[model samples]
Target chain A: MSDQEILRTTGLTMRFGGVTAVNNVNFSIDHEGELRCLLGPNGAGKSTFFKCLTGQLVPTEGTITFMGEPIAGMDTHEIVNLGIGIKTQVPNLFNGLSAYDNVRLAAKRKHLKRQAIEKTFDMLSNCGIENLKGSEVGLLSHGQRQLIELAMVLAAEPTLVLLDEPAAGMTGEERDRLAFLVKEVTKTASVIVVEHDMAFIKQIAKNVTVFHRGEIFAEDDVKKIMKNKSVQEIYLGKSADAA
Target chain B: MEKSILKDPGLYVMVSIGLLIMIFLPIMMDMFAIMQITQYVVLSVYALSLAYIWGYGGILSFGQSCFFGLGAYTFAVASINMGSTSLPFILAIIIPALFGVLLGYFMFYGRLSDVYLGVVTLVVTLIFWKLINHTAGPQYAIGDARLGGFNGIPSIPILNMPTANGQMMDPIQMFVTFMAILIMVYVGLRLLIASEFGRVSISIRENEVRSSLLGYDVRRHKVVVFSIGCGIAGMSGAMWATYQTFIDPNAFSLEMSAKALVWVMAGGVGTLAGPIIAVVILQWISLKLGQLNIINNFVLLGLILVPLVLILPKGLLPTVKQWSQDLWTIWKKNKANEGDTIIKESETVNAGRRK
Candidate 1:
């Protein structure tokens, strides 16, 4: 919970062919044990920015530093080893493996065999799918599979976690459970959730960053961000008019 | 120890069948048949190398014969110069392994896609085949062994007992030796697959990006697995040289590579026993068909493989495993239903008696 910067990106930009997906975005996160939700419309470049931070995409023009070390050209595995966990837009668990195995594999990187097994069970339990540990991840429902993927990220015990659209296909009850889980995770690790669902964001977000057209449109507390005119114009649209 | 082996029915079945063949086959078959079986055993080892890479490591190597040919050549050259079997055997394994590491470094580190990797390996095999075919002159001689080109280098020394100097192995001894080596290789690969390294490799096969994000160096793992597979292929090549007592450029031909792929596909990828069984069955069928004058052996093999491939896309062993699992689940469900019916009947009887 210390006020030390865990991640910083200076003028981060990603270009694919002639299109600039993420343009000159300067962002930093200093809240070590707090949840930060990123709100953006489709093609607003939040996913692209997340990819750059997680080393899935190297920024064409920007410098990304994690804990004051340059991580722009580092490999994804190397970035993970540096204690950053990422869950992509799609649930990326190994479908053939059991839920326990998915978490155990990630835990194996940071723990001994015996400890990893124990930690995997704990993670699955925390995610409220301990009963599904023996079930193959592929057989689980979308929400259950998403939970397993989150448990895998938690098993790694990362200092920073980046989640992309974690509750995309969840039921309302599942989304509420996910919101609680994200809030709980922030107590131990810094969490940045990129979500489009304003309801889900409202449940967990204390600090919010609204992205528009590959740039940061607004950065403020949830209450203030909801009232921001530009964020309302781009995101809420008709809903804002009714309000 | 006994309980663990008994837990795995497939292992138990494979071992019992292998032991029965080793013990009884020699008594039942003639010397010529035993010799042919030994050749098949050698080829089974070659097929295993492909299965390990293709099935387990998710690497499709279309030019695996490059390592096999290199191993045979190294064995022939070293045996002729050193006039000893021991050093030549070691050289056969080491030379191919080193070559695999070198080639694998470029392919893996350069981030070549799977198709490109196959193409590069196939081209490398062709290069070796063409390069060795032209070495037909006196200048191509190494020590007392002359590079005979298409005719091949003949009268190559067979594997000898390490303790007994100048003592060549008899056909029976070679047969037993190769079978023992094959068994050891199978066990070793099984142990490897059960290890942490094996789990990581399987994860890599399932999803490379997920494995990488979990802090696994995907490229390094690929290279290491590819090299090990190449080394195994080389060992098989060394055995082939010893069995035939000749080494040739045709060892590096595309035909050898294609045959290996067929053996793996027919047997099953991913499982060690599958490829071994496939190679033995195919070799036996090919030999039997060779006696016939009407059909070519290659065409006969094609006929057998086409149906199997079309019917069972996952190959023999995996399909069998899946079917068995399905049957077991059905049986378990039937048993549970029977138990529920009995309970209901008892409850009805109790109510009638009370009334």
Candidate 2:
């Protein structure tokens, strides 16, 4: 609701039959370029919450507002048109198409014809994926494919980017490059990364939201979150009785 | 943008040669052969309607004949009522397009796709077939034109020049008109596929979820493409009606729908020219088989088709294209004294989904 806020969610919740995937929660991110990380164990509701934001899933109860517009339960295209870039957990790409074409389409959507051509090449190079431009994405390695999707999402020049486990299947060197590319994106857009890699999180994230039992158990500076006793206990799979 | 479609030297040459052949071949053939080619031209348009929707939009319907039959019936009834041949063509195109919009809205908007989409289309065509079959009574008349059920509507008006005082097209004039129409439809589709919207449609076919997340209205695009294809089918149906001077429920038959799928698959699914050429070749084969009478026409056609599909799973045209590309690459490598680099380039040419 505030001018500084790019996105805000009020009492957001998602339930599947008997189980609550994302419990009631209120969350917001600033309009300023910032890299925020969502960290949680396997089923701590981070991905569900991300899906709700991307309009891939309609929450059982909640309201998601982006840039003064209500986007919760809106069509995926409608949500995307509101200046949000979305990437699912896996690489969702046009596998049959060349990588150049994949980025070209995204760039074309957000710019004029001439500018689109320029931006497509620029984004491809910026993401360090210019080499794979002519290759079919389906045949590319997992890390390379992830970077291509990153280039595509960045090509649109969105105000907010929601990436789910972008470095899920990457080597250490690839993760380092991904971290660099993601930081470059944060210079222009607000990025929310849902990831499990603490080392990767330490590299790019400033603010980290640690989710536990379908709720945000801890929210702090990345350095502080790494050392907090309670957060450590939750992350280590230690119960209160054992502690 | 469409004008630039024929700008490619290779494609431009091929299209010009193909058109010239169509124009000249009728001169050498007898009236019977000319009329048969006209029939194939009309069917080419129908097959193209399927090619556009399924090949590009990735929405395969087993009941494209529903639109084809609607156009035929619309032209028949409207021409008979108006007592003029010219205006009914437009109605033929518009009615089926309107129906496409209606049906596409239900299927795409409701997300009823894939196998369900195929079944829904199949059921729709069958419903049309059943509905038209039951219109045997005089009460089924639309104004002056009666639905004669299985017997069909005869004495239908033939096509006339739009502003030539109702002068009907003769055999030669009709042949020329049909050829021109076929060429325009083919070029227009090529233009459409080369545009930004067309590229986006291809991307949607590759991955619907990704296209949507990338800010494309997947359902709306599919609906529009489906409707455009329906309109083309209607135009071809009108052409068929004019040629036969009869309209029947058989226009909506399952066999009519299946032929479109077969022609597209047999020739090639992705190329615009593939389905059109396949329709003509297969129709000719069926005609030849009918004359020989050594085997059932459909069965013999199937016997040939099965082996063709087995040998080249990607379809006739695409495999031929890949083979040509490979040959060209090998020649280039030999001439330039390059080996590994040319081989990689050749693989890129052969395997890349879109040219």
Candidate 3:
């Protein structure tokens, strides 16, 4: 492990009885304030790999080291408290609570009461949803809810941030806003995004890791990967080459 | 963030009004009415215990009465042996709280949740009920306080002033103590709900996985909430014991547990005021039913509850609050539209004058 490396996983494998969702894979991020994108086709083990890192799903075989500590099977809260922030694929917010409360609770977890309030409002305004603070998260549109969850994730002040399918249901405007926020987050913390939208990735990603069939298929600069024959073949279903 | 309760003068003013009523209640009512109301007030405290855990924490423990009975039994036995009220009174809350810690550790730490958690608590209450019932033998006596089994302990010491040889409270004074404590519990719970602990507990209830991923120890928060409920229920149970001067194994019965649930569900699952109102109304109906003998208290309760569940799924208070809010919005819209029409009418008249 290098001094700047924030996380490293060795032989990371996840199996569901007969199915190995994530095969033995070694991965790492070796710089502060880095932004990495994970791209893949469906069933490519991107989400499974993300889950392994967050402790949402323990690996059948692997060792995960983060910030110079072994945290493979630690509780999710423990991992989060160690300065890793996570946002699940779908927005799982407190539906009954106001948007302010949802962000405030997350902010409150890391900061003192006054600072938490300040941070909450600051994050809300950053996400451009300060006007919707009083509205219930459950009643908000998909884009609005996605932005709120991103605000919540940023409120924790994590040194490492993980986001899963952040642009899944977002409009073009919402996607650009999310991309801007992800870039801003990368200015202070290393961010790893798992996304299916290549256009969304192009806006912010410089380095990318492609997953295929439960393994890391390729790791390179996003520009090189975009033009690579195999990578394009994998994405366009192999017939784009013949056509 | 919820503004601290201390900043809310309205709550203080409301409680002050409740205090005034407390002072006047005994003077205005007969002893029989006072006694019944006192019991209802104590039961309200017990109901609040469940409301906090179920409504906010989203832990629906069906065995709340087991802790209530534990508190009652603890008070009875401790007061009998000690021949004083002070130590027993404190123990009434602490013992049940300790039990809560133990039980909560198992349920929350073991990752029991939702229906499974509910069933575990229900089974626990039954275990206590059966265990207490079997202790009819003289061997069941701990020191001087008898287990009394199905008969329960009788002539337990009344609540008293803190002294070496305590002076027992008169009926009116006892009534005041019970009423004051109920108000205090209500205030304390409100403040707690506004605090970090309360908000986090609500978050855990909302989405445990999300809360954990955001860096909260969901299990620990849950255990603290459960224990707090136990302590509150225990305190109320002790007061109930003091009022009756007796307690029996029936305190742990399934009926007692169900009654608290019905009260919380019918009154309002989330608000403290709802359960108190529900308890008073339902208990009053129950008293009336006892006199008429037309229907069993529970039968009438079930009849009322089914509709309450069907019509107002959020419970009575929250539903009523929503209705008022909806009505207010409609009124505001109407007022705004009326002003718009008046402005449009004036503009049309000006245009006609110009023509």
* Global fold similarity of model 3 (TM-score): 0.89
**Model 1, C-alpha of B22: deviation from truth (Å):** 3.1
Q: Over 4 Å off in model 1, which ranges?
A: A17-19, A210-218, A223-229, A234-236, A239-243, B1-9, B141-146, B323-355
Best by lDDT: 3
User: Tens digits of per-residue lDDT for model 2 on B98-161?
Assistant: 9999999999988888999999999999999999998998998999999999888998898998
Clashes of each: 0, 0, 0
DockQ of each: 0.51, 0.54, 0.68
Q: What docking class should model 1 receive?
A: medium
**In candidate 1, which residue pairs get closer than 3 Å at backbone N, Cα or C atoms, i.e. clash?**
none
What class would a CAPRI assessor give candidate 2's docking?
Answer: medium
- Please give, for residues B208-227, the per-residue lDDT of candidate 1 as tens digits: 88898898998899999999
Candidate 3's docking class is: medium
- Tell me the whole-model lDDT of each prediction, alpha carbons only: 0.88, 0.87, 0.89
> Which scores better on lDDT, 1 or 3?
3
